[model samples]
Target: MTARTLHVDPSNAEQARSWDGEEGSYWAAHADDFDRALRAYQRPFLDAAALHRGERVLDIGCGSGLTSRAAARLTVGGPVLGVDLSGPMLRVARREAEREGLDSVRYEQVDAQTYPFPEASFDIAVSRMGVMFFADPVTAFRNIARALRPGGRVALLVWQGLERNEWFRSFATALAAGRDLPVPPPDEPGPFAMSDPGVVRDTLTAAGFDTPELTGLERPMTFGRDAERAYSFVSGMLAWMADDLDETGRARALANLRVDIEAHATPEGVRYASAVWVVTATRP
Candidate 1:
């Protein structure tokens, strides 16, 4: 497929992605890694989204189509569309769909921030750690609302805070290697962007949804069989650092994180607890 620049929510969306031509390929290559990570710790979030079967559902930022596949299994009469910006991820999803013979689930490569989905179409929209990448969440939620049936609902599972997520804190700390790397601002355009309850309510309301109910979303993040496994797991981010790191710097960074992982490791394996906000709102 040719690379094309397209508007997501509108000419001026708050949350948009260019993908840099790698979104698809990167996720496609690591589909199993992504799936395993999600399955071990994200069952609660998926369970909450798969509610009310026979109602059309949209899986936004549906990387590798895990939630999309789950959505299809949950709905017998209604169909589900999995939208993502990565072509490679969609390819993996297609193969998985074929393997499972999932006829009701369909996947598409498109920007979720501004895609022109029909108004009042979906019964529910579910996103698992996907909705936060939008540069402008207010616009993204509004666009999401455009695709929902009246009284439809939107549910999301997003990271709560950096301090609360040990895996990420350890990852960042180890990657820093004595140089003070600034933690992402709380209001930045990522998972922590939606951590605030006031902001969550404001964004949902601005996007045409009623006041949202925020449920505490927490789970154990089992990284690997051991600390070594945990170190290897985070190498995904290291691989995608988008910077030229000399061999020494890279090795040191990895070593530092490995030690941290070892410190946090348990007898059974590398388990880190993370927290997220399970936000739900109705489209009024």
Candidate 2:
């Protein structure tokens, strides 16, 4: 596999913008699965955020507006703004909001890590597996904290270690032949970027938040009506992860993914069991 850049720096916006500009069509092709996976992983974090009626909310990296709309539905009278860097994703979000006649939900395409939002503008801020790609997490969390009123709740969901998470770890191990891959640097952005509870606490406290807490949960990442649909969904995921693989390696990665799907299929569908961190903190 060749070394390629990733969307680790939330500040750069270029990589994610590139991933979206270039990889968005690929992601869009699997929009349904993406939305489903997000929804399944989001329940605990949303409950942690405890959105109340008439309280404005901010959803970071609100791809396709699924979580934003869900938050709006939970809020009843509250307005929710979904922000993302992908134009196509934001467009989808906008279209979906309009189609649902959801006036209270809006989507904006912006560099979420550095965007200059009004101070203390939201009663709550929530993200479903979206807060970990910041190149400079300190700035990102501080900015997000500044956007929330003091004592306003901030809750986000993040994947745990690759080992604890089977779907991603399985794919990585299969494609890489169980070779030990270096985890993201303590401060570098990537999946599992916020996995460590101590780091999460320290980061949130440094960002002007208090008493950051992390709760763990497990969920089934179900896909498709059957194995075919399941395989289709996981193939796209393989593409995202195997972008650097050579032809032979890529081919093998895909084959391994198929094996994984077949092995994990349930009576209703194929579901990858996943572990997550539902982290919540109050802006102090």
Candidate 3:
């Protein structure tokens, strides 16, 4: 969808720009790689949802529709709606759903934080590493809760602290190239926004959901089959890290990233430890 027709909260404007622009384009292009990287979390996250047949599903921030498609399959005969701010990723999601012949799945380009969803219409809401970037999470979640029926479930997979996520820590450190990068606040609108269990619990409670249950889950995230391929994938995803560096520093940073990624290479693939919280709650 074009910007003219896109609806988003004022607080989420910056995020909308990034997710709908180059960042979104890159993710859409490498959708398979991303899906594979996070494959280990799929079964567990979905399992937490405990979906039943004929249960309407709302997939928030459903990039590329991996989880949404899976939800559709699990809730056969039930309608599934996947919403996101990125038109490019939504396009990929739509195409994949069509290719899978999932007539029950539909996609929309809209911000989950402020989208006017049909009230009390959904049986469950799920997000895979997708709910943490909300500028106002409580408000975002409140919106989600309103869209759900009483007793409707909400399940989310969110990254743990950066220190516990080896993939991010190692990559960011290597990319820093000895330059100290400023850290965003723990509760900022980013990947680690919901990392703290206490914050997550509080947010959900304030948003009109039952106290959230945070379950710790650990897994190995695969970047690519080999170091070179992993480097290409990672560098593409985080090249902005080195954007302010000089020529020599940028080269050095890239070399450091390659070395670090190579250290994680295994016979099967380049993998690194990742910790996440599988948060579950019920709408009151």
- Poorest lDDT segment (10 consecutive residues) of candidate 3: 1-10
lDDT against true structure, model 3: 0.93
Candidate scoring better on lDDT of 1 and 2:
2
Per-residue CA lDDT of model 1 for 1-284, tens digit only, reads 42455445453233333342554465577677656655654677766665666889999888888888877887864788998776667787888988988888888877777778988889999988787777778888899999998889987987787878877777777787666776777666765877778888888898889999888867767666677766776676455441456789878877787788887788867777778888888988
- The TM-scores, one per candidate, come to 0.89, 0.89, 0.98
Candidate 3, residue 235: the lDDT equals 99
- Candidate 3 at residue 20, lDDT? 91
Q: Which residue pairs collide in model 2, if any?
A: 9-135, 10-135
Off by over 4 Å in 3: none
Reference-based lDDT, residue 154, model 1? 84
Question: What's the C-alpha lDDT at position 30 in model 1?
Answer: 63
Q: Tell me the whole-model lDDT of each prediction, alpha carbons only.
A: 0.75, 0.76, 0.93
Stretches of candidate 1 above 4 Å error? 2-20, 240-245
Give the per-residue lDDT of model 2 (tens digit) for 163-261.
677777666666664446555564677778888888888888888898788888888777766778888877766565676778887788778877877
